[model samples]
Each structure stands twice: as structure tokens, then as C-alpha cells.
Target: MLVIFPACSVFRFQVSQGKIIDPPWRPSIAGMIRRTKATVVPVYFEGMNTLLFGILGILKPRLRMFLLPREIIHQTGKTFKLKIEQPISYENLFEQKLQSDVEIINYLRQRTYHLAHRI
Candidate 1:
């Protein structure tokens, strides 16, 4: 989905819905689950999202360069050691950027909480 912005034409909101597509072949239920086990997280969806977005912010250019259709590429990269040319330095800039991110997260969390519990 695209949302037109009066301020900036480049800014748009795109969202994708979950879908199950038909495959040419079918697998046993157990086999399917086994195949997906490596990617499946039985708990803590919030933490998973935080980790994902944090990595995304740190590596947006590299992320965009090796663009895949879905988030699967990022997940699979984690399983193997990726020898990226300009790997993110978690030493210096990370601390500064991370502080900013933490502030934004806290601000958003507080705003959401207040919105939910508005009197």
C-alpha cells in the first residue's frame, strides 16, 4: 500500500499481509515443521522485532543492496557468517545511534501507553 505525503513525495507507507500460496508439491506436516524449525520463534515476538529493526537501522544500505522479497534473507544471513565489505561497527557510532534509538523507543512506548490509558 502507498500513502501520498503532502510534505515529502518520497515518503510512503507500504504494508504486506501474510499469505499462504499453493506449492507444486506437498510435504508431510512433520516435515514442514522440521523445515521451518530454524526460523520459527515459539515465544517473544517483540524481542524478535526489536532485534530485526535494530539490525535494519544499522545496515540499511547493505540491506537494500542485497534485497530479498521477504525478511527471510536477513534471518538466513544470521545463521551463517556474512563477510560484508562495510560491516557495521558496534564500537563507536553504535553507542550514539543506539542512545537515540532507545530514546525514540521509550518515547513511543510512553505515548502508546498514555494513549491506551487516557482518562
Candidate 2:
């Protein structure tokens, strides 16, 4: 039950700026979801800015652990939020071939985006 947003969906720079970029997921993840008959549960990671630190780690090519975790602790406050939306059945969603992969992924991204902004 490990749901993963492909790397392309996220922005490396945007994380440092505390922004959630819309995913650019192609048909791959969508196809997998369909084939596996998995329920698409939109999970949003809200109020996290440790990504920038990771970026720094990538840049430095050293002190990876220190920079990443320290940045996370420094940037984040005491409270953070995680939103888990209801499960969306792939079969129900894709009953018809009306929507393209981009369309479906965009809709899911919008859901996560809205959830992230709630705080």
C-alpha cells in the first residue's frame, strides 16, 4: 500500500520555497493504478519545507544528513499536518475513456493542492 508520486510530479526548487507544485505525472502511475486495481487515496503532506535542505545536500554532495534534517527542524514549526482523503476506486473513476492521463492526474493534483492549502 505504498503510494508514490513519481519524481517528475514534484519540483526540487519549489520545496525550498515552501510551495507545492502541480504534479506532471504522465500515464505511468495512472496506468499502474488501473492495472493493480488499487484505490487512489490522495495523501497531502502539508507544512513541510525540508526539501530545500535536501537540495542543499544535493548541491554540497556532503554533510547530507546534517543539512537535510537540521533544515527540516529549523524551518518547520511545532505543528505540521497530513491530510488523507477518501479512497477513490480506479474502476469507478475510469469506467469510461473520456479522460486522458493528464486530466486524471491533474484532478488528483488539484485535490492534494487544495488539501495542502487548508492550513
Candidate 3:
């Protein structure tokens, strides 16, 4: 099974100041990883907020009232870049000695933001 977890509990836009505003990740994800023995893949998305906001400006109340239309969204001429980093193996987490769910999630959160810095 493939599961995607948003590290943050709430939706936050990427700021222009070049600093990522990362809130504490939900610890349950770490617990899930431990139970499922899932390999953690850190993926960072750049320019998604700009794209969505830009589309919102064009769509206005239509977007606010309804779901985003895929065809219109695809035609926005905005490019969203995704950086997929090396996966963290279940064994790797054990080797790192992350004993608690919080520690594991924090470690994964840091690794994810590290990719943003590279962009």
C-alpha cells in the first residue's frame, strides 16, 4: 500500500523569504512507518502554492465554491517542480536510534525540508 502523509497538520504556503515554515509533523506517521515497515520517501514540491494561488485569482469564486477543474489547472502554464530524495529504509531508522514516534517524524521532516534548501 502506498500512503502519502503531509508532514504538516495544516496547509501552509511556501514563503518568498526562502525559509521553509515547517510545523511539527504528525507523530502517527512515524508509528505507521514502524508498523508497516514502510520505506520513507521524502518528496518536496516547489511552486505549487504559486500555481494554485494564480489559478485562484483567475477562477475567483468559482474555485472557492467548487473543486478545481483538472483541465483548467493543467492549462495554467505554471510548472510545479518535485524533488524526490533517497528513501529512508526501515532499518536505517533503527540504526539512527530514533526511539520515539516524535523523533522519527522530526527526523523525516528535517530530511524533507533539506531538499527545499537545495532548490
Candidate 4:
């Protein structure tokens, strides 16, 4: 399935300011996973946000690519890294019903936060 960012979520950041903000994770995702019995794979990308290029992207709103200008995006003078955690089973998530959608979202956000902090 394609990854789509719902409104008021990650893409709304002003400047890739090296901060981790947890926007609401739509419950619909959980619902869909439950319906389809799919595993939720959390993939984290580090350094995907470069301040200047990220600001440009925020301003432009149309030129949407993981990286805007190849040069400036990496101009932060930092290298990038990617982390992929083990797929989270929907069955397991459903079994653990105590965690709400917001909690699940925050958990995922924390995963990303830890991943970002590496760099």
C-alpha cells in the first residue's frame, strides 16, 4: 500500500528543524490493517529534512520529492541513514487493544525519533 500523510501531520512542519513531533495517527490505518490483516512496517528515514531545502519545500508545496535540490538537501553537511524495524503484526496489535490509535501513533513517532537522533 502507498504511504500517504494525512492532514496536520508530518508534512506540516515549518522547517525540518531536527525535531520529532507526533501528529495524530489516524485510526483509519488501524482499521484498514485489521480489515486486511496486514503487517504494519515502520520505516524510518533520517536526514530527509534539510533546513533550507525543507523550508523551500514547505513554501513551494508542489515540488514534492523526498529530496528537493540534490545539493541543498544534503547541504546540512550531514550524512543520512535509514532504519526499518520488524513488521508489527496486526494480529498482535489487535490482541493488545489497550493502546489507542494515538498511543500507537506516538509509539511509531518515538521509533522515528530514536532513529533521527542517531544522526
Candidate 5:
């Protein structure tokens, strides 16, 4: 920030030191008409398309279904996987009793900490 501020100030002073902007070419009559046509045509088409589709999508069920994902499945089948297909988080153990190794490790940890603090 300290480095950028002084450079920005210097650039601002140079621009304020008298200079005038001149466009390199004056627009010809044909160029102006082409620019106007290019701007108007796409805007008119977009507005008309938006209004046409907006009404049709609301009035037509098939068109609306084509535009949106259908909630109902065309085919139904029961899942037959016997075990979890994805990796599981250890947090699921919170609802169950701690396994034997976990209890042993925790007991050792507390015993070591208590002995060290007592000494």
C-alpha cells in the first residue's frame, strides 16, 4: 500500500499537467448508421424472444418439463449394496461405546499426564 500510493499520486500529477484528448478519426456517416443498426437488432430480437418463451414456458407443460428436471423417476429400483459404498467419518462412534484400544490409549495418556504433573 505504501509503495502504490506515491506512484498513483505521481501518475495523477502527470495527467493534470496540461494535455488534451483528440479522437484519431471522426466517424463517417456510414460508420454511424452501421453502429446504430448493430446495437438495435440484437436488443429487439432478445426482448421479443424473452416475451415469447416466457409465455410459452408457463402455458405449455411439455415445454416446461423439457426446460426443468423432472422430480419423478421414470424407473424405480431397490438399492442392494450390503456395505457403505463411501468412506465413513470416525465421528459416527460418538453414539457407540468406545472400542477396547481407544479406552486403553486414553487410560495411558491420562496416567502419563497425571504422573508428570504430580512429580
Candidate 6:
């Protein structure tokens, strides 16, 4: 099974001024990884937040919020970039000497953001 975890607990719209937020990632994902020995693939989407904000800008905020799902489904002619890094082996994760599950998750979170910056 594939499990997707966001680096932050909060949504992008919760922040003001379109600032990039780096709230602490939930550590439960790391625990799950350790228990299941799941290989992790760090993935980052660069333009998704911008697209959402741009849509909000064009339409009334409240109405847009309600229509966001439909807008995303029906809208066309927009491009976004995504980067999927090489998978991290379950053994490799322990070999890193991260000290704790939280640290392992933090390491993965850093790699994901690094991908975002590079893209």
C-alpha cells in the first residue's frame, strides 16, 4: 500500500500573504514507516499552492473556496511541475543514524523541500 503524508498539518490557505509555511511534520508517519518497513519516495509539487491562490484571486474568496474542487477538476491550460526523488529504502533509513522516528521524518521533510526549491 502507498501512504501519502503531508509535511505539514495545516493547509496552505491557513497562512496569509502566500508565505511558504514549514510547520512541523507529524511524526506518526515515521512510526508507520518503521512498523511497516515502507520505502519512502520524497515527492514535491512546486506550483500547486500558487495555482490555488491564483484561482482565489480571480474569484470571490468564499465562493471560490466552495468551488475550488470543481475549479481544479474543470480548469485547463495551466501547468505545474512535480519532482519525485529516488525512494529511500527501509534499511537505509535506519542506517542514517537519525536517532529517532521524528528525526527520520525531519530528514525526509528537508529532502522534500529541497526538491521544491530545485524545481
> What local distance difference test score does each model get?
0.30, 0.63, 0.69, 0.58, 0.27, 0.71
Q: For model 2, what is the C-alpha lDDT against the true structure?
A: 0.63
Q: How would you encode candidate 2's per-residue C-alpha lDDT over 1-119 as one tens digit per residue?
A: 87686434333344456753443666677767766878788887665446565467447635554555565568554775689877878776686453666666767777666776675
lDDT of 5 by residue, 22-113 (tens): 11222232233233322111000011113333345446634634532331232134232221122212333222354444452343233323
Candidate 6 at residue 101, lDDT? 77
State the displacement of the C-alpha of residue 72, model 1, in Å, after optimal TM-score superposition. Answer: 22
The C-alpha stretches of model 1 lying farther than 4 A from their native spots are: 1-99
The residue-by-residue lDDT of candidate 1 on 33-118, one tens digit each, is 33433221111111122344434534563552233335444456454322212221234323334344344333323333343233
Which of 1 and 4 is the better model by TM-score?
4
Comparison by lDDT, 1 against 2, better one: 2
Compared with the true structure, what per-residue lDDT tens digits does model 6 show for residues 1-119?
68575553323443455664545787888998999998999988655544655456445445545655665665377777779989999999889998787898889998887886673
Superposed Cα RMSD, model 2? 5.0
- Select the stronger candidate by lDDT from 1 and 6: 6
**Candidate 5 worst ten-residue window by lDDT:** 39-48
Task: Tell me model 5's lDDT, rounded to 2 decimals.
Answer: 0.27
Residue 36, candidate 4: alpha-carbon lDDT: 81
lDDT tens digits by residue: candidate 4, 1-119: 75644323344454566653445667666556556877777767555455655566667755535444564545565766677777778776667663666665556556555665563
Best by TM-score: 6
lDDT of 2 at 106: 69
Residue 1's lDDT within candidate 3 is: 55
- Please give the distance, in angstroms, between residue 74's alpha carbon in candidate 3 and its true position after superposition: 6.8
Error of 4 at 116 (Å): 4.0
What's the CA error at residue 107 for candidate 2, in Å? 1.6
For all predictions, the C-alpha RMSD in Å is: 20.4, 5.0, 5.2, 5.3, 33.7, 4.3
- State residue 77's C-alpha deviation in candidate 4, in Å: 15
Question: Candidate 3 regions off by >4 Å?
Answer: 8-10, 13-23, 48-77
